[model samples]
Every structure is written in C-alpha cells, then in structure tokens.
Target: MSRKVIVTCALTGAGDTTSRSEHVPVSPAQIAADAIAAARAGASVVHIHVRDIATGQGSRDVALYREVVRQVKESDVDPVINLTAGMGGDLFIDPSNPTVHLPGTDLVSGLERLAHVEELRPEICTIDCGSLNFGEGSQLYISTPDMLREGAARIRELGVKPEMEIFDTGNLWFANVMVEEGLIAPPPLYQLCMGIPYGAPADPGLLKVMVNMLPQGAEWTSFGIGRNQLPWVEHSVRLGGHVRVGLEDNLYLSKGVKATNAQLTERAISIVESMGHTVATPDEAREILKLDKVASA
Candidate 1:
C-alpha cells in the first residue's frame, strides 16, 4: 500500500434501496449534496446514478443527469465525476414467455445508455463490459459486443475515460478485446464488481486472478457488495488498486447502523490510512486516471 488509492463514493445507485435505507439520496439536490459531502470526507471520485424522484427507481433521463452534474460542478468540493452509463441495460425477462421482458425492464442500445455522458461530458463514464444474470429471479443485464464496441468508440470520441465494469471473467475478456480493437484508450480503467448474485463471487483468490488478467498499466478498482464492502476496500488497496464504497452497494456502517454517503467515505479513508496508505484527492485522482483538469480551475 505504497501509492495513494482513489476512493469513489457511489452516491445513490440505480437500485431499489431507497426503502431499505432512509439515507439514500433521491432528488437531484440530495444526490448533489451527497456528492459534495462524500468528496469532503476524502473520496476522490463520485460515482453517480440518478433515481426517478417519484418511484425511487433507476433512470436514464438526461435531464435528471444534467441537474445532478450541474449542482456538483457549482459545489465547493471538486471530486471527479463518474456517471453510470450502465442503467439502460436492465432486462427482466418474463418467467412464462422467457422472451418478453417484465414490467421493470429497461433495455436499450449501448449508445443510448451514453446520452448523459454525451451531454454532461463527465470526466469518467462506465461501460458494463458484458451482459449478466445480474441478480435473483428473471432479471438480467444486457451489453453485447456490438453494443459495447459502439459505446466505447463514442466515449473515446467524447474524450471521457471509460471505466470498464467487469462483473465476471467473460466481461474482462471482452473489455480486453475492445482495448485491442483500439476502441478503448490507453491505460484502460476497470471496475471488478464482486458478490453480485450470478457474477463473480467475493473470493480473494478470484479477485487476484481478475486483477492479474488486466492489461499491463491498466488502472483498476474492485468492490464487494453488502457486508463485504468494507473488507473489499482493504482488499483492493492491498492488491495495489483503488476502491469504491457508498450507500449504493451497502447500507450499513456497522452491524445495524444505516450509513450516509459521507460516513461511508470517511470509514473507507480510515481503512486506507490504517493500512499505511494515503487516499488521493480529487486532483490527484484525475492525474492518476489521466483525466483532463477541471475547467476554470
């Protein structure tokens, strides 16, 4: 743990966790406030996913994204913005038909998912590398090679770094293929998502294997959902990678304590610090990721 680790705080995920935790930010203003607070708490980057205010469900509306980004930009802190382009891929297949999607399904082309990234032009945008049986029941997350290729090209053109989201080994394989095909830029970023039902398990050995599989000079991060979140922070740092934590992945700060975004961020910083490693500031993270300097800085 010699180098500074970039801690990303995912404010409010596109999940149905609002009912689970009262701290999950819902409105554009709340989300923006959470981002600022997390940045102040030592997060170098803020991974944002806006929710529909009325239903507390994930949304791909560019207008909603616009408002969130706008508020953050005007705020005091300067954490790097990483918008989630992973929303438009939710697919809830009907149990009976198997072909038709369920009520909560929201499937679209890869390029369509980048509407916010295109308009907002955040420093970093995510590309969920491949499809997955994301969780329990009939839900799936879709992202074909064709869709990914097009999305990568568009993000590259937009001059935003693509944080390759790898749920399993296959996703990593396809991400490498995209990099080799020249769609992804140099020093590609990856996010190894663990403990998500049907994806990779939350095993240290497996995370090491996935980390080894990353292309040379690639910067990556990993996170384990639920109770594994905090432990995964230390795991990622010890493995020479960055880390992410927030209410999006887990709700608890302790055994029964519901955590706020800022509290989760502070706790993550404490973990990194206790491990003899310093946490990166917003500017340092940008330099580490090779992202552009902030405008009017």
Candidate 2:
C-alpha cells in the first residue's frame, strides 16, 4: 500500500464487556488516560464511548465527555477525537409482549443523542447509518431516516465531521442516499463495523464489496469485534482502507491475552508498517479525511 493508513482506537465500547475484561476503562480519567496512551502508541484517532462509573454501563453524559476530552486535549499527545453519538438508541423489548420495554431500555431522539457532541464538539462524531437487531435479544438500535436527517443537518451546521458507521449493506445504501441528499459534508468519513452479532458478519468478500460501494474519495476504516479485530486490521489495510482496533472491539491481543488500547494500537502500527505502509499521524489523518481542527470546547 502506497498510502498512509489512519488507525483509530475505539476505547471501551458501550457493551457489557466490562464484566469480562479487567482492562476496560469505565471512569472519565481512565478513558482519557487510555486515549492519551493510544495516541502515544501511534493511533491517529481515538473513538471514545463513556461508561457509567458506578454501574460500568454505557453513558451519554456530557460531563463525562467533557472531562475525558479536557484531559486528552490538555495532555501531551494530540489525537483526533471521535466521540460516539451511537448511544441512547438501545431499545430492549419483551418477545412475549412486544410493546413492553425492558429495564435497560434507553430509546431517545437522534438529536438528543448528540448532547455530548454538541457540547464538546469533537473533530469527529459517529452516526449509525440505520437501525438493526443489535444483539442476541429483542434489543433494537434505532436510527430512523428522519432522525438521521436531523442529526446530519445539525452536525453539518456545527462543522464536525460525521463518521458514518456502516454496519450492513442497507446502512451503506442509506448513507449514500444521505450523501446525495446533501446531509453530510464533503469527503465523508465512514467506519465499517463488522462481526457485531446481528449486523454484518466479518467477511472479506462483503468488506470488499462495501469498500467499492463507498462514494469516491471517501475516507473509510474497518473493524471486527472479538477474535476478528487484529486480523481485520490486515484485511482492511490489504483492501486499501484504514483500520480500527482496541479493547472495545476486541479484548485479546492474542488468544487469552487481554489487551490495552495502546497495545492494540502498537499492533496495528506494526501491521501497517509490515505491509510497507506508513501509519498516519493525527494531522495527516485530518488531511486524509479533509477535517479542520475543532477548538477545545
């Protein structure tokens, strides 16, 4: 590969992986420290999802986001921040009584989900392209057309790049539709998420097709959760797209070996280098994605 590949570290996802992995960071200070460490390890971007400190569950708290971002910006390393706006869409329903919402249900409007993004205004914020049966339950992650349109319009107004997440072909199709409708700004960034239960499986053929499906000149990255994470780095780089890795997507650096954000990032950098390609810095990544620096807010 002749191009500089951008590596993103997705630290501590909203999932209940905390119970399984001791390495997952839940508090704001820990998340910020992890983000800084990942940046120092050569990651161009840090994709953050705050977790509730008390319960260790995913949170959309602006205060948490503020503290994390503040710490990162004040740190020595400057990595591109990509906050998750994919929260607040979780809807757990009872199969027997479809209308009954389960206890952990967190359904909210799309704009409401952007509370953190609006306040912190990071360089990038992810927008899930469509709704899907998120996992092995009646849980549905909702992102309707009208909701998405409204979010996109607001994100454009704020001048923060929306990192469109493509979990399936349908999501990709709608993202393209959004592009045509002018909801997204130019040189859109896309993150192809795979191996997430009910969404797209971690298949190379499908990944290639999805890459082809992306609009010309789009900056894209791909990742697979669990065991597929590290291998997916190679897969994504081989296809000329960027790569994402970290504890959020995968717990282990190798079999039964837990990994930290920095360890995962170092491995990804090694992969990019082994492939005879350079890994991008934050500024280089910003140039690749055509992003302007968002002031600390």
TM-score of each: 0.97, 0.97
* TM-score, prediction 1: 0.97
- Give all candidates' CA lDDT scores: 0.92, 0.92
* Model 1, residue pairs in steric clash: none
Worst 10 residues of 2 by lDDT: 288-297
- Per-residue C-alpha lDDT of model 2 across residues 199-261, encoded as one tens digit per residue: 899999999999999999788899999899999999999988999999998999999888999
RMSD, candidate 2, Å: 1.7
Query: Which residue pairs in model 2 clash with each other?
Result: none
Q: Residue 62 error for model 1, in Å?
A: 1.0
Query: Candidate 1 — number of clashing residue pairs?
Result: 0
